[model samples]
Target: MTTMTPPVTPPVTALNALGFDRPAADTRVVVAMSGGVDSSVVAAMLAREGFDVIGVTLQLYDHGAALGRKGACCAGRDIHDARAVAARMGFPHYVLDYESRFRESVIDDFADQYLAGATPVPCVRCNQRVKFRDLLATARELGADCLATGHYVRRIIGARGPELHQAADPARDQSYFLFATTPEQLGYLRFPLGGVATKAETRAMAAGFGLDVADKPDSQDICFVPQGGYAAVIEKLRPGAAEPGEIVHLDGRVLGAHRGVIHYTVGQRRGLNLGGGDPLHVLRLEPESRRVIVGPRAALGVARLRVAEVNWLGDGAFADAPPGGWRAQARVRSTRPPAPARVLPEGADTA
Candidate 1:
């Protein structure tokens, strides 16, 4: 008699916390450790949760030169701290030398943008070109199921797919610097600290995990440019970037001579050195004419701006926008709040 056997049922794999359809132990995650309390806490938390975690820190610059730098990240000291955290958590840690990549991608672009009279946010470029692009590639090469970071930006899986959202803690939200995150990168990236209510909470968790960076101060200035000295760095990158030029008023009157248009940005007031006149603010920077145009604060008001090389992270093709435009909220700077904006798609990548 042939006995009929019941078919073996396949176990369903529910999505894990990191959104992988498997158990935490089976999912390999790579945490981009910046040696800060926030990232260390993320690594520890994920390790405690039984996930196979690998800690990777990018030595973004010359380690010897970065040593003893306290207010910046990706330095020699940070790499050591990251390694220590990985050791404590019993996870494999690797430090990749990304100095050349950083210089070619982020640093060079920063200098060129200044020369072009445009204020460039190097952190955003670093994330867009190096960390999220190159480092994410490295993570995949390591066989990581996902790449996690300490960025205080939430990645929500909406009906469309993974959507970048502001962190639960608005004060720590890094959505501005992360605007360039592409959809494909969003799918593989996870931000574990996005839901944390506060930095204090992250510090407490780090302390609980016996991590060394529990009370470490947050990195303030750019990692490559120390002490917020943008002009000096620019000069070093491109000689004569700080060439002296005239600071002229909007009325076409020369107010005073100044050192380089790179030293000033639109809406600057304090460093003008006009001495005795109406409080003048930087109206615009003219790199070609080597001019720093100044005028009354009201002159700095902008009605519209043309943003180029736009990276659209919205639902559909940016070119497929409604005839009028898309009403949205836009944050021009990280320090400012989001304001209402009508994004008109001029082309595939501009609005």
Candidate 2:
């Protein structure tokens, strides 16, 4: 039997229908422009709405040396485009040098996670450390009331305080990556394109505003990995982390050799060179033994997970004062849906 899919709605119509109004002329907002169409449109819309808008782009990395030619929207050309858009829209623009901070927070954490045999979500860390945390601080320093981004997620402040909702455009909803945002940060954050439904619509709006990046393609790869591959970056940071290792079966029988432990992740099936019988999946990586444990797919199901460095949204939700523990939705990874969970304080470092 075929299942019917839900109808998709654009963020613009939904947000307007929800009665989200623009700020007044005296209200100030700082837009994080990344030389992308969505951010450009956001700045233009806010400016047109008569709010005091200031555009800021974070120079997070050495894009010229990394990308070789420097024509992309993430680095060199993107900065120029952002400045041009700000000029055209009659808003003040500034570029913040955040390369050292980005490297320390994002790049180092990424390498450390791979080294630790766990998949790290760098985007979440970036948002937590740089965008929401650092950028929001900068906004406040500039005396702005709010900071805005092009992220496709809606912030709703209700009786229970601030709750993040999926964007009206489900395909473009970025709520997953934003799970790390604390309740305090959500209060000062705004996602103008959270209500936008499609890339086509964003581009159309940009074109209407005569923005330079109207036809620019959305960046598909991580900004740091210019070639769209991370293996090289991993090798560069940890020289011997990708050395060859033995691939063993769950029963302790030797199978084949793997290029490296960093090359694999949980629930991966492809590129395992064990002679074909039933398909095999990576169950675990024994870093100490330099061995990769392969098994059938059933071994991948994990009902319980211990997440450290927990950031609770509500007061005392993770404290010891709870009778039955706090009940809320928990998400381990950003892309996955938040599962029902009973949160208990496992101490500061334990979570």
Considering every candidate listed, which one attains the maximal lDDT? 1
Candidate 2 backbone collisions, by pair: 11-195, 12-195
lDDT score of model 2? 0.82
**On residues 1-351, what C-alpha lDDT tens digit does candidate 2 reach at each position?**
999999987566322321345435667889999888888999998898778899999999888665444434458888888999999999999999999999999999998788778888788899989999899999999988789888989987777677788898887888878877988888888887877778789999999999878988786667887665676788888898887889998988899898888888878899887776999999988777778899999988787667687766565545663766677787666557778987666786344
RMSD, every candidate, angstroms: 2.2, 10.4
lDDT of 2 at 40: 91
Best by TM-score: 1
Q: Which stretches of candidate 1 lie over 4 Å from their true place?
A: 1-12
lDDT of 1 by residue, 1-351 (tens): 999999999988788889878889999999999998888999999999999999999988875755677947878788889999999999999999898999999999999999999899999999999989999999999999999999999999888899999999999999999999999999999999999999999999999999989989999989888778888889988997888899988999997899898988888889888898579899899999999999999987786888787888788878888877877898888999999888888887777
